[model samples]
Target: MQPDDIDWNIINILRESHQNNNSLARELGISEGTVRQRIKKLKEVGILKIRASINPDVLENQQLATIAINIGESSQLEAKAKEIAQLPGVLNVSITSGRYDLFVELLTFSNKGLVKFLTQELSTIQGITSTESFLMLKSYNRYV
Candidate 1:
């Protein structure tokens, strides 16, 4: 199925439950093959990903923190961000347009683990000038 042929009802159905392809197709009055084809095309074009994501809060030993890092050189932004993304606890990284050069979401099992990550790992990165961290105390809305 082509992008233009994709109905909003199909999108709604998919959003509601991507796993239930046959149910979605039946509700939208289309064949399951059509839904599968569209989903495949969407995945091919980098529009969709069906992957499981864990909630860190569910894991009692884990802690999540958002750390904003200021960089010394704009030229090293991409390379530095990529390096930070590879760090053990680093879950997500984004280069943003603000006072900080990059924002990183990290997860660690203990205070020592997080401190080791920030002081030993993150501090050694070439372009990083400063880091400000905010520990997530509580969450009102956890869904991504």
Candidate 2:
């Protein structure tokens, strides 16, 4: 189904409660079968994901950081960024239109782990001129 055709109310229900499909159906005035089918469809189309959203910091042995990297040459930017994106602890990487060449978000087990990623792993990659890291102080209103 197209984006316009899908009922976002189902997603709202999903965000509120995952286990109670019947409750969602009752609240939305749809059948359980319909909810399941729509959810399945959404998943298939990459529009909706239903899973446990965890706070990485609260979980033992998890670390999260945002790293900004500057590249010397503009031409080699995409290639170098792709190479860095493959490294462990990298959750998501983006090549943005900004002063920084690249932005990388990471999650790891410890400070040492992240240090290894920044120092040994990323530093060794060609075209990397400078690096800046920002440790998250607090995350607010993050919705799944």
Candidate 3:
């Protein structure tokens, strides 16, 4: 679906603040019903999602890491990524172009948890040629 000017405005406003339909309508100079309908349509088309976000660094015992993975065969890239995404602690899996075929973001309990995920969970997946993990020590303005 093509997002028109009003839709883009709504998205921009939503990014700044997830206000109620009445407030959004007031700010955008539109009716509350219009705001509700637009928001519903945007969500239905996968263009918008409203959810709470928290910084992982503030969470106790939680550690964030990114793993660069090389798939043995190009044909298996998508399948392997899908499989990996279902694993525990995997926050996101992206197919990319570079030295690695996929980049996986993980949120483990601690350093030991990260180790376990690498050695136990990730290692069990076939077609994964190699992986390089980068554990995030500190982050600024990072929320997921």
- Give the TM-score of each candidate: 0.80, 0.73, 0.91
Model 2, runs deviating above 4 Å? 72-85, 123-126, 141-144
| lDDT score of residue 126 within candidate 2 | 84
Q: Write the per-residue lDDT of candidate 3 for residues 1-144, one digit (tens) a residue.
A: 989988898999888767899998999899999999999999999999988777889899989999999999999999999999999989899999979999999989989999999999999999888999999999998877
Order the candidate numbers by lDDT, best to worst.
3, 1, 2
lDDT of 1: 0.79
lDDT per residue as tens, model 1, 78-128: 999999999888888999997898999988875677898988889878878
Candidate 2 residue pairs that clash: none
Model 1: lowest-lDDT 10 consecutive positions: 1-10
lDDT of all predictions, in order shown?
0.79, 0.79, 0.93
Worst 10 residues of 2 by lDDT: 135-144
Off by over 4 Å in 3: none
Separately for all candidates shown, the number of backbone clashes (residues 3 or more apart, or on different chains) is 0, 0, 0
Best candidate, TM-score-wise?
3
The sequence of per-residue lDDT tens digits that candidate 2 reaches over residues 1-144 is: 664433588887667767576887888787989878888888899988777766774566667788998889999888988898899778778888887989998877778888888878888798888889887655665421
